[model samples]
Target: MLFPVALALIVFATSVLSGVFGMAGGLVLLGALLALMPVAAAIAVHGAVQTVANGARAWFSRAYIDWRSLGYICAGIGIAAALLLALRYRPDLATVCIVIGLTPLLVWIPRRWLALDASRPLHGVLCGIVGGGLNLAVGVAGPSIDIFFIRTAIDRRRIIATKAAAQVVSHLAKVVFYGGLVQAMTGADWWLVLVAAPFAILGTQAGYLLLQRLTDQRFREWTRWIVSVIGIFYLGRGLTLLLGA
Candidate 1:
């Protein structure tokens, strides 16, 4: 009872955070879910719920999407997905938690130095491979993918929309890859995904409305600090778990 209720709250809040800042929500969601369930189950559930949340965000911001970049990124994601299946990689919970917890810190990377050219298909593909693999492993690759978007020709709206679009594919791939692992779960687990996904959409809508009121610079400034704090938390928790193990 308490688990489902807590999950609902986490899903809503994190979705809003993703909606407003264009990322970070999944990191929080994964971190919280990890505490309540087995790593594989938590990842599978997160993948399913995030698939809906990102899909909704993409659809809502469909008009702003950058098609060319999205295409190349998708190609990369496909490759990564294929590679994952071939590898049969199954990460341990403590390691997965550390990776997820540290994800938000990618926000602070100096874009000026990296200047990843997303205009090139190879770059998008490269990001896709990295982001896609990371998504499967950790459940969210927003900050990793965000690095590719920085300094791109697309404006803020396009970045957010296109990234959301890319995430739709990323999360869906994650679900397909992780989905089979969860088939044995009780009906309650499916209920968690069903309930959490919709709440995530609602939270996203609320966040979108709030986003309209803020400037791009302001949005970046505010979300960065909050996400960093969350990153620190995951880092602490994950390390503690790993060491204790």
Candidate 2:
């Protein structure tokens, strides 16, 4: 009972954030899952689950996918995934926290000051590596990708679609790479996935509607503040875990 309820809340929250900000579901899911499962298993499961959710979203918004940008990003993600698998290395919790916490800050400078172009394949590849690697380590890949997209100045629908597409590929790659470790889902897990699916769909739809209602300037402002707040919280959490002070 508790598990189902928890899964629903997770899907709902992820949907709302993904919808409103055009990304973050994987990050939020990663953080929540880490508390409950082994980090590697959590990442594998989160990637598998989110692949389904994001795949659905990408289909729904198929009209807006930026194929050219996605091609480059997928290439980078593929390379990153291979590197991660080849190494089979896991970062310690403190290191994981710090890395996850700091990634957003590192990307922000180039995004805000350097005026990097998200539409560029190089940017997508870089974002993909960061996002994919972090997802493998900590289960959250949304922030870096979000920063990249936000910098690119894509409209709401396109932002949502393209992100969803990229995430779909990233998560699918993770699922495949980590397949040996992810045990078959128990009956209970499958049940949770089934129950969570519809809510995830509904939440994404709500997010799309919300995006349609907000003006471009308002959307940009909202995204910036939200990303900043999330980054600060991640940093604080990382510090607490790392320093234990």
Candidate 3:
């Protein structure tokens, strides 16, 4: 009971953070979940809860989603999911952590080479495939996805909304990829998801309201620093575990 209560509170807070920051919620939630449960259980439960969080954010910010980008990205997501399903491949924890740790570093890639033209659909597809594959492996890829969007000229709201929309795909894939395993884990704690739903909704709304105050430029700047910090954290954690091993 206490665990559920605490987890539910986390769900609300992370959702609120994502609601305001438009990213980082998954990483925050994933870290918390990992500390409480095994990797498989953490991934599934994170996917389920994130589904609500991202879904609500997307709906709230639906006006700003780049439909063309979403279309191409969804196609790429389908392709990646199919390949993963056929191969029965998902990376092990050490690998997932290492990769997750490495992604934030991509932000440093020189813009001359890394910059993506927002009007192009192929970029979205490619990013989706890569990001989707990684999401399956690690359960979240917003940091990587953040690198993709920060290159474009789009406004912060659009970036947040579209990314939330993309995350819907990735989070859903996490559930489907870990389908049976996730279901089995949730068989006992499904109530936590139910109990946490409303709080998640409220939290997203709260974040949305908070986002209303920030200038677009500030949102972008803050998100970049926040993502880099998160990357350092994951990188450090992954490194400690590997070195200790």
Candidate 4:
């Protein structure tokens, strides 16, 4: 009972964080879930919860979503999902953690090298392909997807909305990849995810409200530092576990 309650709280808190910042919340949630559950199960549950969070975020920011880009990104996501399904890859805690930990480094890449813009059809497809595969592999891809948008001329809200829209597809692909393709989720896992859904929605709403208060400059700055810190912690944790293993 206490465990479920705690998990729900984490879901709510992280969703709110995601709602405001657009990406860090999922990274934090995936790490917490990975710590508590098996890698496959953790990714599956994270997918379900984030599906709701990102879906709601997309809806909230629907006015700003670049629908054309989302369509192309979805195409790339389908390709990536099919490729991952064909490989029948399995996930382990250490590797997944390492992958997740390394993703934030994308935020620090030289701006010139990251000229990828999601609004461009080809770039959107690439974002979907790489970001979707990474999301399936590690259960999160906030920073990876952010690279494409960070270089774009879009405003903060569009970045948040479009990313949320793209992530909805990516996260759904993850849920299917791990939950159905990998056959990882149990009935109890589904139940917990369902219970956490409402809380996620609430958190997203709260975060969206808060997002209205932040400046574009502050949004980008905070996203970089926060994700970097989280990435460093997870990197250390993964290394320690890998060494022990």
Candidate 5:
């Protein structure tokens, strides 16, 4: 009972974080779920909860969503999902954490080296492919996806809206890709997702409200630092786990 409540709170808080930044919340939630369950089951449950959370975010900011970019991204997601399915890949906790930890470094790269603008069709597709693949492999693609949008001229609102939309499809693919693991989930796991659903919605709404209050400059700045800190933590955690093993 205590565990369920704590997880639900985490869902709500992380959803709020994602609502404001459009990226970090899923990473945080995935890490938490990984700590509590097997990799496949964690990804499955994370997908289910994040689908609801990001779905609400997309709905709330529907007006700002870049539909054109989203379409291209979806195409890329399909391609990545099909490829991963063919490989039948499964990640361990250390690998997932390591991949996630490294993703934030993409943000620190000089914009000149990778000036990816998701508004363009090609870049959108690339974002979808790489980001979607990362999401499926590790359960969160926020930093990878963020690198594409962070340097764009798109305002914070559109970035949040469009990313949320892209993630909706990406997470759905993750759930389907891990469908076997999802079937193996227990009733208790499903119940936890059920309990987290409404809170996810509520958290997104709260985050949306706060997002309006932030400036574009601050939004980008904060996203960089917050994700970097998280990356460092996960890097240490993954290394520690590897060493212990």
Candidate 6:
């Protein structure tokens, strides 16, 4: 009884944060779920629940999405996901932890110094492929995608909308892939979905409302801080995994 209630609260909080920051929910959910369920089952459930949350957010913010950019990024994500599936390369947990932990620092240096040219399809496609792959491995790929999109001159609303939409597509793909891998859904999995779904929707709504109230500079600054914190968490988690501590 208490477990489901606690899980729902965590889901709601993470979903809202993800909605506001454009990412982080999956990592939070994944860490939480792993403690309660098997790794494979947790990933499947997390992917499914996140898909629902992002799908709702995408529809709610549909007017702000940059369809053209989203289309190309989707294409790249589709291709990359398919290839990764075909190759049967499972992500190394320790390596993923390390990469995710260090990704913020690595991305920050280039983001600060380099003049990004987001107008190029090539750049967008590349980021999409890498981002999509990372999503499959770790369940959160927003920071990389956000960094790429930030290079473009698109408005903040459009950035959030487009990112939400792209994440919906990515998570949808993951749910399908994980479902196939898991074979049959257990009773507990269904219960998790039932328990987590409503909170996910509520979080999305709260996030969208918050976004509407923030100024552009404030939003950007907030996003940076969010990314930094998430990166640190990822790095610490990875190091802990690598060191078996």
* lDDT values for all models: 0.82, 0.72, 0.79, 0.88, 0.90, 0.76
Q: Candidate 3's residue-wise lDDT over 77-155, tens digit each? A: 8888888888877545666667777787766666677767434688888778887877887877766676667567788
RMSD of 4: 1.2
Worst 10 residues of 5 by lDDT: 175-184
Q: What is the lDDT, from 0 to 100, of the residue 53 in candidate 4? A: 96
Model 6 regions more than 4 Å off = 110-112, 115-119, 183-185
Residue runs of model 1 more than 4 Å from their true location after superposition: none
Residue pairs with colliding backbones in model 6 are 101-235
Model 6 agreement with the true structure over 94-187: per-residue lDDT tens digits:
6666666665563455556655433467766776787787777666675777667756888888887888888888888777777777655788
Candidates 1 and 2 compared: the better one by lDDT is: 1
What's the lDDT for residue 217 in model 6?
84
- Candidate 4 per-residue lDDT, tens place, 1-245, comes to 88889989999999999999998889889888888888888888899899999999999999999899899889889988899888988888888878878888888887887678888989989989999888887788868888878668889998889889889988888877776654556688789998999999999999999999999989989989999999998899899989999
lDDT of 1: 0.82
Which residue pairs in candidate 1 have backbone atoms (N, alpha carbon, C) closer than 3 angstroms, thus clashing?
Answer: none
Q: Is candidate 4 or candidate 6 better by lDDT?
A: 4
Please provide TM-scores, in order, for all candidate models, with all chains considered together.
0.93, 0.86, 0.92, 0.96, 0.97, 0.90
Model 1: lDDT of residue 26: 82
Candidates arranged by lDDT, highest first:
5, 4, 1, 3, 6, 2
lDDT (C-alpha) at residue 92 in model 3: 57
Every model's Cα RMSD, please?
A: 1.6, 2.6, 1.8, 1.2, 1.2, 2.2
lDDT score, candidate 2, position 17? 74
Please say which candidate is ahead in TM-score: 3 or 4: 4
* Residue range 207-243, candidate 5, lDDT tens digits: 9999999998898889999999999988999999999
The best candidate by lDDT is 5
Q: Write the per-residue lDDT of candidate 2 for residues 1-245, one digit (tens) a residue.
A: 78878888898778777777765565667677667766666666677678767877888889999888888788888888888878886646556556666666643454446544558978878878877776665666746776677567567778779888888888788767766665744566556667887778777777777777888778766766666666676677888987784
